[model samples]
Target: MTIRYPNGQKFTPVPLRDKREQPRDHVTFSNRGMTLEEDINATNAYYLNCGMAVIHKKPVPVQIVRVDYPARSAAVIKEAYFRQASTTDYNGVYKGKYIDFEAKETKIASSFPLKNFHDHQINHMKQVESHGGIAFVIIRFSQTDELYFLPFQALYTFWCRMMNGGRKSITKDELTACSIFLPLGLSPRIPYLDAVESMYF
Candidate 1:
């Protein structure tokens, strides 16, 4: 299948590993070569099962353009295009508070580049906050296996600085001061809600 962005650019998805070939070591909080999305999905599943929260990933709207009828019972989609840009990765309600967040991972150890975020996403988060909703970001330093929950306000400060011709990235030291450090665990892989509770609730 071929998918394209709204701007007519080809969208190639990252190849995923087979689950059957992966190890089932759920005892440790190690990286285990899993992608950030996979970890968050697992955490969300656990949260749902435990009745802790109701969060889900936002699905990207796509317009199907072509389909191949390979068989009478199977019709394969051949081409599709995204209808619009996504606002955020995940959203839901927790403890009666609306939650919305974007998760990103980088291998850089010194700083997290602001280029990882888009202006529309920032604007969306701001609107979410203005409407009395909880908005934040989950940043993971892949090299050091360090994770941080950065609030929308803190992120807005750096974003504004960048727009004013300031530093284009947030340093590790700055994140340590402004963001909540999240330690990975077993039951709920990335325990981000704990940080959220400490900061917001």
Candidate 2:
């Protein structure tokens, strides 16, 4: 299958690794090689099951262009294009407050590159905040196995600095100073709501 962006750029999906290739450790609370999105999905599921919150990943809008009838009962989509660029990863309501956030992970140890974010995403977050909603970003430093919940205001500050021809990245120390550190857990995986409660509530 071939999927293209709204700008006609080919979209290459990341290949999933086999679980058998990963080393099994005794520490269950650790991330255990799960991607940030996977961990968040698991945490959202837990929240939903426990009647804590209502959140879900936003689906990308795609327009199917070509399909092949491989068999009488099977139809294979061959080509598709995104209908539009997505704003953020997830959004919903929590504790009667609107929640919107994007999740990103990097393998860098010293800093997280600002190039990972897009202008539209930042603008969307700003709009969300302007309307009295909570907007934030969840960043994962894969090399250090660290996670941080950075509010949109903090992110906007760094983004504005970059736009003004300053540094092109956010240092780990800067994130530590301005963002809330999220500890890994077993049931929720990434315990971000705890940080949200501490910072916002």
Candidate 3:
């Protein structure tokens, strides 16, 4: 069967990537080789299972353009596009306090590049803060497998400095001084709430 575009043109699939070219697992948090996002999702599941916290990843809004109805199955989506730019990655209620945060992974060990973040994300964080919600960023140094929770206040400071033509990134030293180090755990994988409880809650 040939897949055609909306305009009757053939839809050529992108070439498959080589297995060796795939992202290599760096951290042994679970000893099972999971990406940072997967680990965080597992952690959130663990939290929800035990009635600890209620954090969740925000869904990306996709506008579906076309769908194909199969013979005996549900319709399959053929085309879709994002409705708008994503704000934060995750948000929920933890102990009655509104929790909103973005998770990022970078390979740089000395400093985390601010280029990974967008202006809209910073603006959303500011909005969350103004509304008395807990806003922060969870950063993982993929090469070192080190994770840190940097609050919005600290992130804002670094962002402003970058805008002022200062350093374009936050150094590891600065993160160590201002951020909360999330210890790796066996069950949840990324036990970030421990640091949150210690610092904020």
Candidate 4:
């Protein structure tokens, strides 16, 4: 099967992991090993435990068509399909303010590809912004081990330019000028809310 963007641009689903290989031990603690989803999940748990906020990853509902019961063991999923396009990776309340955002990671050292985002995601952010909620993206540059908090307004500006035949990636300088770098830590490894407080609040 093939997937295409709304603009008819061919979209190739990047290889996430080779099914025939097992991840090696002693792998560095980087975005290559841990995805944004995993980091946010752990952070959300920390937030809840510390009474900081209530946030959750929205599960993508799916229909399971086939399952293989191999020997008397666990069942393996054979076929499944997403029910619909996901709105956002996460949403919650922080300091009595509603928050909605998406998280993305890039291996590129210089820029984040615009292709990493979709039109639906822009629309979702617009909706959040319209509701007077905080909307933004947490972008991680794996090569540099740097994470930045980019507000939705900045993202929307870049997105608009992309639609007008601008560069497909946001340059490092642009990110530096428009985003707030989040400090790494032990608990809530990516302390983005700190940046939020300093910049937005």
Candidate 5:
């Protein structure tokens, strides 16, 4: 099966290693082998299972253009196009507060590049905040296995700084000082709501 974007760009699955066959010890950290999207999706599943939250990844809608019938019972998609997504990555309700955020990971040890974000995402977050919703970012340093909860206000400030000739990214030192660290756990993996409690409550 093949998928493509609305603009005719081929869609590639987010790179993910086969967890069943891979050695668990291959990476030092619990999240070492997992991509940011995978971890967040898994964590959201955990949350849902535990009745902690109802967050979920928004499906990337696609427009199918071609299909082939290899067998009577099997229909394979040969070509497709992805449609534009209108919302952030994950969202749901937690204790009456609407939670919405995007998760990103970087290999850089010192700084997280602002280029990691897109204008549409920033606008989405701003909209979330404007409506009195909980808007934030969960960024992980994959090389260090450190995750931090960066509030939208701080993120917006950083964005402004970058636009005004400041550094194009946020340094680890800055994150350590300004963001709340999310301790890794075996179940939910990213305990970001803990950071939310500390900052908001």
Candidate 6:
């Protein structure tokens, strides 16, 4: 017998025994084909554990509307959506100062597109800067695996130019000159806080 979903698609049913024997490391998808965001998040975890500068990914809250109670053991999400882009990507206190930043990645080698940074992201960063906090974006060129710590002020500069009919995308050369290059490391992977320390502290 085959179980068909509401969409008229056949649902493959796993044997109960096989389901029980399923691997515990399903979350290890990152280990297999991880992203720059995942690497940076792992690095943040390391920093938190070591009592270093505290930083964390800001969760986008969602209103859960439906869930499937497959069994007493599991509650599966059926539908959900983000409430809004409320704030920056990450925020925390670092050495008596507040820190806030967004992380982004792009494959285009010549330039980082302005579309990557939304107006809300820029507005939130501006608020952080106004309050005397550190605001920046950690951008990664996925093709090269190179990362940079771009300050919010510098971004705002380019943002102004673009708003006034200038180049829409920032060239890689401009990024290299305006931002601090983050050192890649084996232990922490991104080693972003190192760049932060060198800049502020």
Report the number of the highest-lDDT candidate: 1
Tally clashes: model 3. 0
RMSD per model, one decimal = 11.9, 11.7, 9.2, 12.4, 11.3, 10.0
Lowest-scoring 10 consecutive residues by lDDT in candidate 5?
24-33
Ranking by TM-score: 3, 1, 2, 6, 4, 5
Worst 10 residues of 3 by lDDT: 25-34
Model 1 accuracy (lDDT, Cα): 0.87
| CA lDDT, every model vs. true structure | 0.87, 0.85, 0.83, 0.82, 0.81, 0.80
Model 5 misplaced stretches (Cα beyond 4 Å): 1-34, 67-75, 82-86
lDDT of 4 by residue, 81-187 (tens): 96654577789999999989888887678888777776988898998899899999998887887989999999999999999999877999999899998877879
Clashing pairs in 4: none
Better of 3 and 6 by TM-score: 3
Model 1 lDDT-worst window of ten? 22-31
Least lDDT summed over 10 consecutive residues: which range in candidate 2?
Answer: 24-33
23 Cα displacement, candidate 6 (Å): 36
Ranking by lDDT: 1, 2, 3, 4, 5, 6
Error of 4 at 194 (Å): 0.9
Candidate 1 residue-wise lDDT, 113-142, digit = tens: 887787899999999999999999999998
**Pairs that collide, model 2:** none
lDDT tens readout by residue for model 6, 123-155: 989998998999988888777888899988989
* Residue pairs of candidate 3 with colliding backbone atoms: none
Cα error, residue 102 of model 4, in Å, equals 0.9
**Residue 105 error, candidate 6, Å:** 0.5
